[model samples]
Target: MEIKIKNLTKIYKNIKVLDNVSLEIHNGVFGLLGENGAGKTTLMEIISTLLPFDDGEIEVAGLNVKKEPLKVCEILGYLPQKFDFFPKVTLEESFDYLCKLKGMNNSESRKQEINLRLQEVGLLSEQKKYIQELSGGMKQRFGIAQALIGNPKIILIDEPTVGLDPHERISFRNLITRISRDKIILLSTHIVQDIASTCKNLMVLQKGKVNYFGSTIDLINKVRGKVWLYNILDDEIPHVDLFVSLQDKGSSIEIRYIADNPLQGSISTEPTLEDAYIYINRKELTV
Candidate 1:
């Protein structure tokens, strides 16, 4: 599915959560990187048609989100930053209830579908466990299972890996990557490594505005030659603004820095996506 947002704006009282944002998202895993209060959730809500925007036009899969919300919802699956489930309900029961809410009526077929989704998310073994009994990671997986019930073409996941441990996070990211082959999966997160390893394209938001958006390679290429590596004594570390620090086998310290001129013990260094993001944001902040 194709998602297009144009001149989108949202406000709560006098605070603007989204400031005339515009973006076009196509099939693949597109990462949304931003800090808290950067409007990531607000943008997701507006795109999912869960919240009305103060101004803007959003079209998903060729259907207008505001005017044709029902159609939009039919092909959309959204796992918000904070999801709630019935306290006393079991995982299986919760899926059943969500299916009903989505207008599914065939009990047997729904159960089979839910079971498949649970298995896909590695939660099938915990299907009979009560929602309250599940751990944070389990509950997040359950939320993902519920979001996949309708075979959505456009999936929006907000902070999907927030509470997951390193192992679970990798598993979840892999699952999302596999599922994104034919769908447009919008994953909003603050983890640069997540985007670096999983997403091919990304959008970086700063203060409710898009600071950068494009292919990951293009973004990383921006800082390609600006990064420098310096082999410095531990005592000299404080003199450089280290972008990355590593310990050498010989007790020397290797540091990546941003400098206009070559330092006393510096060499050219390759920049990573994180370096590009830091450079862009730092430049923006200074202006």
Candidate 2:
């Protein structure tokens, strides 16, 4: 499957939310990386046929979204950042309802599909649990299960792991990794670690524009030799430029920052994906 977005633009009132954005995605897991209000969700909404764009074209699975929305919807599944299921219903009932909404009329077929989706997301044993009884991570997994209802060729997941413990985040990532091998999955989030670990290719967005688009390793390599670690008194921390990360160490603070020239007593350090992300975004902030 392939999604082609060309010169896409979206305007809210007079402001440009997505300004001439364009991207091409094939069958694999691709990430849309950006902070809040950076137009990542706007682009995803346009591609999913949920919001209309001011200019440009979006084609999903060879179908033009504006001209054939239903056709595109047939092949698309979206899990938004915030979703609420029926609080009073069981997991199976909720899945069944979503299947019905998706136009699945055959009861036996819906039954099989619901169970299959639950199994795929590792919630088959908990299918009978009430929606209100599940934890945040389980609810998110159930959200994913609902998105897979129609077996869409393209799936869009927005901020799936924003508020979870580390263990739950890893589990959710693993679940997405397993099912994304054969489909075109677009994982959208601001967390650098999410894109670094889950996606092979990603596009970084800044103020509704593309800041960087490439393989994860290529992005990381951009600031490889430019990052350094320095120890400084807590009062001196305010004077450093390009501070990417900071850790408090009692009387002093350890700071990892990006700079063209290293400070005195500072040692060069390896670059992480977060460091690379900070480098790019910080440049934009200064500009």
Task: State each model's C-alpha RMSD to the native.
Answer: 2.7, 2.1
Report the lDDT tens digits of candidate 2 across residue range 29-139. Answer: 899998899999988899998999999998898999999999999888999996668788999888998899999999999999998999998999999999999989999
Query: Candidate 2 has which clashing residue pairs, if any?
Result: none
Q: Candidate 1, residues 77-100: lDDT per residue as tens digits?
A: 998875668879888888888898
Q: Each model's C-alpha lDDT?
A: 0.84, 0.89
Q: Among these predicted structures, which one has the highest TM-score?
A: 2
CA RMSD (A), model 1:
2.7
Candidate 1's TM-score reads 0.91
Residue 163 in candidate 1, Cα distance off native in Å: 2.2
| Top-scoring candidate (lDDT) | 2
Worst 10 residues of 2 by lDDT: 278-287
